[model samples]
Target: MCKALSLLANSQNLFVNLARVAIFIVMIWIGGLKAFQYEADGIVPFVANSPFFSYFYKYEAPEYKNYKNPEGKVVAKNIEWNKLNHTYIFSYALGVVICLIGILTLLGIWFPKIGLVGGLLTAGMAIVTLSFLITTPEVYVPNLGGDGPTPNFGFPYLSGAGRLVIKDVIMFSAGLICASNCASRILSCCACKAK
Candidate 1:
């Protein structure tokens, strides 16, 4: 019984280590992309076109156009645009913060506490963004004239907007995993000392 328990614990530790490593790699990649604007044409362009990216653009992108409300009786004005430099600085700062958190988490330097905080922030942002996208009626129709009327695609759940909504849910789950006890549970099993 003792030997079996020991073996199980070791296996759990190995799994946790692997997960941490994977998370680190992904974070580094994302952070680098945001910081350097590397490959903006490749993945960035595709993601920009994606429903998930649309939410980001709606709130953050100055070039995004505003649309009339569902009633079509009133035209919506564009939100005030911040200066390009200000927006870039804010975005870069956010990327740096996320990168730092990811690095600390991967190191297991702070374990549950920092991990929990980082995960919570990530999850919160995703949820809020998701909610905004879900509630908005306007769908982003790429390549259409910027000032043209909004397109009408029936069935809210079947539209491209739906894809963005679903993607946010998946992203939220990933954040939850980082915030939850799964990592700690595995660590405990391995007899690894928690930070």
Candidate 2:
């Protein structure tokens, strides 16, 4: 037990590196998916509602609700609407940015200066994503009338989208951690050079 504890304790740096790798993997996979039609369509609510991003779309919030394309399903009119809104174009550009951030983060394994920038960008991206929880109405369960008043249809109650957005908190922390680690490395190099 003591041996295992010691090994685990000694592996902090390894785990941090692993976190960078994990970030890289997640960013790459999710970013890559943005190029696809379904994935691009899925982000409409968040983007359309976001004050920071709503301008990217031709239509306004709530307008996108009418054009949603469920995963694995498609309708021509909806596609045409999305095209007019430049959904795919925005998504492609976002994907490229995400992929670049991931690459920069992964490169942090060796280049502390670059890694620091990457880590900060990762945190920034996560912050933007987390903002969707507040800006996107879809993030919460709506009070859709049913047999009676829905017991859980607001604030504290999280819909699937809310749950998804909430998870960005982890990415935010990891990005800070990576940034700190790189900063430490950079400082240490500077100190050694002074000697």
- The C-alpha local distance difference test score for the whole of candidate 1 amounts to 0.50
- Per-residue error for 165 in candidate 1, Å, reads 6.2
lDDT of 2 by residue, 1-195 (tens): 999999999998899899899999999999999999999999999999998999998988898878889899999999999999999999999999999999899899999999999999999999999999889988899887646555678797899989999999999999999999999999999999999
TM accuracy, model 2? 0.96
Q: Report the error of model 1 at residue 26, Å.
A: 3.1
Clash tally, candidates in order: 1, 0
lDDT by residue (1-195, candidate 1, tens digit) is: 999989988786465555556656756766666553222222222333446544443243323323212221322231123222133344465567657756755655246666666556556656855764544443333443445485544445334645655565654665666666445655675686544
Off by over 4 Å in 2: 146-150
- Considering summed lDDT, which 10 consecutive residues are worst modelled in model 2? 143-152
Candidate-wise lDDT, in order: 0.50, 0.93
